[model samples]
Target: MKPPTDTDTLTAPADATTVENPAVGIDQTAGNFSYKVDYAFDAGTGLSEDTVRYISSVKKEAPWILEFRLAALKKFFSMPLPTHWATKDLEAIDFQKIRYYLSQGQKPKRTWDEVPDDIKKTFERLGIPEQERKFLAGVEAQFDSEAAYSNIKDIVAKQGVIFVNSTEGLREHPEIFKKFFGKVIPTGDNKFSALNSAVFSGGSFIYVPKGVKVAQPLQAYFRINAENFGQFERTLIICDEGAEVTYMEGCTAPKFSTSTLHSAVVELVALKGAKIQYITVQNWANNVFNLVTKRGIAHEDAEIKWIDCNIGSRLTMKYPGVVLKGERARGEVISIALANDGQHQDTGAKMIHAANHTTSNIVAKSISVGQGRSTYRGVVHIPKHLKGCKNNTECDALLINTNSRTDTYPAITVRGDKNSTQHEASVSKVSEDMIFYMQQRGLTEGQAMSLAVNGFINDLARQFPMEYSVELKRLIDLEMEGSVG
Candidate 1:
């Protein structure tokens, strides 16, 4: 395990963490974990008003929702691919070739033991049930297009916390769900947002009551187990005045030659003096495309924070944002992205300082391996009318080899003299010298590489929960295992 010398360059190598060449029955990760579900409800293939109607009718949604879906369908058709500023590869998406929805047409079981055997086995393999029992106050498990299991701890539920799937929430708690359903992220926010609105299904809707603090995090897991399928889940979370809550989501999909699409829209609202933290860790097979839109609004003295990690997708474009709508509101985004061979990770954050004394921060780090590419596209805005507004942005990229690429595009507009902002960006390759030095100290090249990569993002990783931070490091190590070639 000799380390490369100055004259010997280490180009990017294919990632070994994901499964090599996919066969018809193999998943890219989780030890070939996948389910052969027999969905009873299918919206057929493609995107059309009919397809939208089918999905709405199957859900037996209210007339208003059907109207919303129809309107969003029109918008999805009217909007062109956002290739002008985004990657042109978006054109590869063929709405006609993708299935809009697929479901077992069953209600989510409240208990894990009550879930279907096949679905339960899938979650058991993913360790979702165990995680929920150990550390989570609530958990929602969605398989493909519908929730297979959803439950909240009794103690937490008794505190007036409402945690349920979006459909259930809308049907059972309209007064609260309707008030903030599409407020933070409107249907027209983007093409994908429109698409999600047109046929969204199986996502979490959470409401934290005033002055109540959730001691444990609420969790959601989204699994894609079918081929040539599209999953669009819409999640909405609201925290009343002086309330605090944390929600974490994990996503994964099997390896499919035909490709899978995951387009989701998440919206959050934090009332006065409330705090909300949203966390996501997505690891899709290289055959899947992950496109998402997430945004939040922070009211007076409220705080919003987004902790995002992206890995293992053919392409990913996500930008979590926050609007500081009231004075003394604060926003923050901490992001980590790793792109391996044949993968592209495009991620960043957005902050809108709408009131005086609003503050925001963004920290993003990306790793590119093999022929993988990574990009950081961000936006920070402070209006001229706002006073005492401040923003800070930092983006750092790590290139594993000569063939990997990284880019940073930051848009910052601070109009008032009273506002202050700082922006910093950097790109660097893994240092062979450091590897050699560590090798001299008896560390193998792979270990050395993993150590360096971990150190690069250690501070951000530490911000995650203890369990998640460990998992994140383990994934980083898996990515490095194949880089030494």
Candidate 2:
């Protein structure tokens, strides 16, 4: 692919302004305060050993970490860009111009009072603090390139649950961090994973010890306020024997004229009898390219579940997967993707049953409107030796306009006769009759469209945390406004 053009090199100013709490008019509310990045750090284009070292140096990382980055950088250089089911527009990525490592302040703040007011208001508007207090066992909020706030409720912390920003975890809990950091997702696994290994920053690290169960979900909110900066968050979660935990991540980027890049790596390890659920709701701006890598490993009798929703982005290519490594393990993935004008949402899941009696289920849905395109590409493999394994996959696509497009590519390989596997796919469009019927009930075109779309995604939405589910509905409703006649 050719390098990004000169026009793509221009970085727009950060759009971190605090909008008037929409409920209150600007006249009645305090003036908007936003953080704008004045100085730009140019992390030259392309993957190189020198670039990796620079990123590590910026973080003041130890020697071993630097070595790991360099190795991953080499892998990134050697790996070929995926030829199938990849965004052709990725040629627009100006690697040289992306600032791989960025920190607005010196260190992550533990107290809200110590955080920059603009950043605080930004999260406050998103109800981060409120959600943390109400439903989360812990919360980590990352603004731009680094986590600005990290907090875990006292009771949960006292339960031997370890929830902290990845950086802090690395510095303070080196033993645990070293054991699992890249074990689930090795640096050389893929191009984006390698890229994340080279320049990752500001993600959550969670460890649920043996026999513990976290009643409340752990939440992490990632916001990109800077223009042309890449956010490479590396998240790791480990649930020891008989433990259970649920993790939710929400991400949004401010509007930008030029595209920003977000390449993240997430790894999960569910040991014997452990259960984990990972949820992600991403609402990136139209001028962003989101390429991410996420996977989990489940041991004997363990379970892993993924709930993903993608609403906005110029181009998004992500597949959250799970590998059942021990007997009787289970995996599940439920996803919904919506693409609107000039957007492409390419996402799905992967399941590899490597042991006896393993089971997996995947349900994927996509909606395309205007000139948007949505595709579901997935894989399910149960090797010949894996006896009594079972898998089920269902993909559904809805196109809202004639110009919109949706496609599904599911690859399933079941080699043993002892295994039972099933796959189903369907494509549909928003019916004019349905719209007219809703209109006859006094609903506007936009409202009808939004309602129909919500109905299609209602099942997946219910899987989200209550607050997230409500917020997601509001966001969808907002995005649907004025979208239809």
Candidate 3:
């Protein structure tokens, strides 16, 4: 595989302003890129009891954590790769050849200058620090298997909001960490979940105090700088009663001849009257298999929302879910996926209405180019005892080439007489007439295709924060560069 070229480098002005309109012009040069870095420690390759013990010892984790990891490892080995469905290419993953963990010995730096030069340059190119200074209330940066830099604004910290890496949070606030860790999504939920639980490393841990609202979003960036490696980060977010917070995460990896793995587990808790929003923009290299499990619990009158955008990966299977465990709880999932040549993005959402008067919504958009494929698998359930429950799901797919493919599988179960459920799906190809019309207006075919794709997800993109929305548009344009003849 070739290293990233200059054209792939994502460059932005230090003071770049966010664009509000999707149709408006964006910096076409802004794109995703990757580079390699040296590591202080590498767990060689393969998985075993010794590997697990080595990881635990390196982190100096508690005895209980070590026990939990060993148990989860046993579970992972006992289970089989998903053979029922979506198993055609999953068998290709060579577990024995993949490195489980790799990291530098440096602790997370509070100041930019303290970060290692190579890692700092990588984050600088990604604009993590600049975004932190401009709008983010806090930022955590992970390179390979550990956090490299973490800092929260002083004012936000003074407000009693705790934003730190998972390791620190567990070491410093065991009371709060132990209460919710693995509570939302258990270790044995699935094969990938078990794998993550066994080898999880650096991820964000946030706690919003009661009644405090974080006006600005907190951000985290994960970069896989090594080849043929796996990144397993565990994230947990807890919101106390009457508090509100929004968190966003981004991920990327370098192109490699061999496959890389990214399996993460994210759990969220929304207490009574609290609100939590989680957003993710995953732009991995085509040689990466991105499998993740994310779920949240919403208490009475609380809300949980997941805004997900998937752009590149060899194969990605993720479905963020929410359990409405209290009356009047609400859950929403807004997603957009783009699959170019040789890529497969299978993504969706799940909503379980366990309480009366609960509501849920799912809106998904997908685009397939060349021989790429996109699939949407969703589930919404309202039991017989639940009353006044409502669910609405919509899935839309756009194919930009003759070889592009898409599939939709939505299973909705509503047993209660008073509950209501609605599902809508559409599959369409880019119209040549629209391309011709745009070309007549002095735009290239590629630009026309990009514009049409952008228009399809314009409404949903508006739901994202301004900065991310702008970056999403630029990424779309970049993907559409060679889509059309």
lDDT of each: 0.87, 0.82, 0.87
Root-mean-square deviation of Cα positions for candidate 2 versus the true structure, in angstroms:
5.3
Quote the positional error of residue 193 for candidate 2 in Å: 0.7
lDDT of 1 by residue, 92-157 (tens): 888899988887767878988778766766776677887887878899999988898999999999
Number of colliding residue pairs in each model:
0, 3, 0
Q: Per-residue alpha-carbon lDDT of model 3 for 370-473, expressed as tens digits? A: 99999999999999998999999999999986899999999899996999999999998887788899999999988999999999999999999999998898
- Kindly list the per-residue Cα lDDT of model 2 for residues 385-480, writing each as its tens digit: 769999999999988878999988899999979999999999888988998999999999889988988898888788777777876776677567
Give candidate 3 misplaced runs (Cα > 4 Å): 1-36
Task: Arrange candidates by TM-score, descending.
Answer: 1, 3, 2
Estimate the TM-score of every prediction: 0.93, 0.92, 0.93
| Candidate 1 lDDT for residue 298 | 100
lDDT of 1 at 445: 88
